[model samples]
Target: MSGEPEPGLVPEHQRPRHDECESVLLTVDGEQFRVCAQAGRPGAYDFDWLSGPHEYGFGLTNSGGLALSRDELVQAIREFLAEIDPATGYLAE
Candidate 1:
């Protein structure tokens, strides 16, 4: 795959975390975080792993969450990343 990154997906490190596929992979601490777009009904899409890693595994606990709008993507990512506690699987206040 090409190393070029996508617009919405952000890359961590120099690696091509973001690919042509509208998805992003980030590594925080020793944890690997990934989010991808899932197709919904016609003319609709939702992001998987919106809540980020909650159980300290590869994927986040919140897989099939509400579909976020374009404007909300960045804020949602920030909120989820800030709230998730990898070890405890609990969101910080």
Candidate 2:
């Protein structure tokens, strides 16, 4: 419950094999959770960590430059993953 993905839980596949850009990737507990807009600007993605709950969400811009620091992204992804509960499908709810 203290920010970690469930041990031995196989992460769900969170990506489409053939996306046409405009995608966001949420990394929670070492797993990739992604959502995307097929018609939006391709690969314009960003993420934010949800504190206290250990969850994160990603968004993709229609058309904009990518501006995410690697350190921040990594931290956010880890925190997001830690928030997920394989049994409940949420932040330890």
Candidate 3:
């Protein structure tokens, strides 16, 4: 094979930059969230609540790693949503 990744494989150097990464907007139970690939870390993702008062709510107290599969990410979002306080749109202390 040539100096290239196999046809079905993605090479690390060819990964998209942070700004170029595609973000997904999800509305779960009327709460909006944005999920996108984390910068400098391939296959890793970062997420934030678009309708929450806290900008760093997801990161502030979350101990989960950024690297997660699509399904895992969705599960994490659900878990995060469960922790939110409907009255304030912030995680429960």
- Among these predictions, the greatest TM-score belongs to 3
Return the lDDT, model 3, position 26: 74
lDDT value for model 1: 0.38
Report the candidate with higher TM-score, 1 versus 2: 2
Give the clashing pairs for model 1: none
lDDT of 2 by residue, 1-93 (tens): 122222222223532243554445555454565444334344344343333233445443333444444444455456545655757555555
TM-score-sorted candidate list, best first: 3, 2, 1
Error of 1 at 18 (Å): 14
lDDT of candidate 3 over 1-93, digit per residue (tens): 011111111244543454776677777667776776655555554565678665532421123433555566566677777776779665567
The residue ranges of model 2 lying beyond 4 angstroms of the native Cα positions read: 1-30, 33-57, 60-66
Highest lDDT scorer: 3
Candidate 1 weakest lDDT stretch, 10 residues = 1-10
Q: Which pairs in model 3 have colliding backbones?
A: none
State the TM-score for model 2.
0.35
lDDT per residue for candidate 1 within 15-86, as digits (tens), equals 222353356554444444454543332222223343443322122222335444444454444445565565
Q: Cα RMSD for candidate 2?
A: 10.1
Which wins on TM-score, candidate 1 or candidate 3?
3
lDDT of 1 at 32: 49
